[model samples]
Target: MDVIGGKWKALILWELENYGVRRFGELRRGLPGVSEKMLIQQLRELEEDGIVTREVYREVPPRVEYQLTELGTALNRALEPLGDWGRDRIERIGANRVHPVTT
Candidate 1:
């Protein structure tokens, strides 16, 4: 869990896995609630962990994109069952959220 245990890490992985290569801005837009700083931090962490690859293109504006490494893809595959359990959990407990939390 150390590598992909953060709040936004798994979602980031899921997004990249499902959508393929993504630029920083595209990743920000794809994940609706993530702030710019958080996204950058998460991406850097993922890259350092060898779960993501960052490609830099020298151009007029300097284009950069991120994709999963082979290890990352395999990790994502391993997360499939966890994702399924989360979805099932949501369905199972969705009704419990009918009331807003007071705190």
Candidate 2:
């Protein structure tokens, strides 16, 4: 939970799960509004948490790609229902205009 708690972590994992393998630039492009620094930080954290595997290709430009590990895939599955529930809740609340104040 700690690893996937970040704002962009789950989204990143979902992207990887859907896309299979993706380069850093690709991920950055896919997730608009995520700064490069934040993307790097989140990717590093995910890698450290054993949720993502980063592979580097020994090429002239040094190609790199990220993919979800087995653990990450399992986590993704677990979070899917939560995501659906959240979306449904948000839609319901939006329709009702139930805006809770935060302090």
> Which residue pairs does candidate 2 place in steric collision?
none
- Global fold similarity of model 1 (TM-score): 0.89
Give a tens-digit lDDT track for model 1, residues 7-75. Answer: 899999999999999999999999999999999999999999999999999997999999999999999
User: Candidate 1, overall lDDT?
Assistant: 0.94
Off by over 4 Å in 1: 95-103
Root-mean-square deviation of each candidate, in angstroms? Answer: 3.7, 3.8
**TM-score per candidate:** 0.89, 0.87
Query: Where is model 2 more than 4 Å wrong at Cα?
Result: 97-103
Model 2 TM-score (2 dp): 0.87
What is the alpha-carbon lDDT of model 2 when measured against the actual structure?
0.93
After aligning candidate 1 to the native by TM-score, how far in Å is the CA of 89 from where it should be? 0.7
The prediction achieving the highest TM-score against the true structure is 1
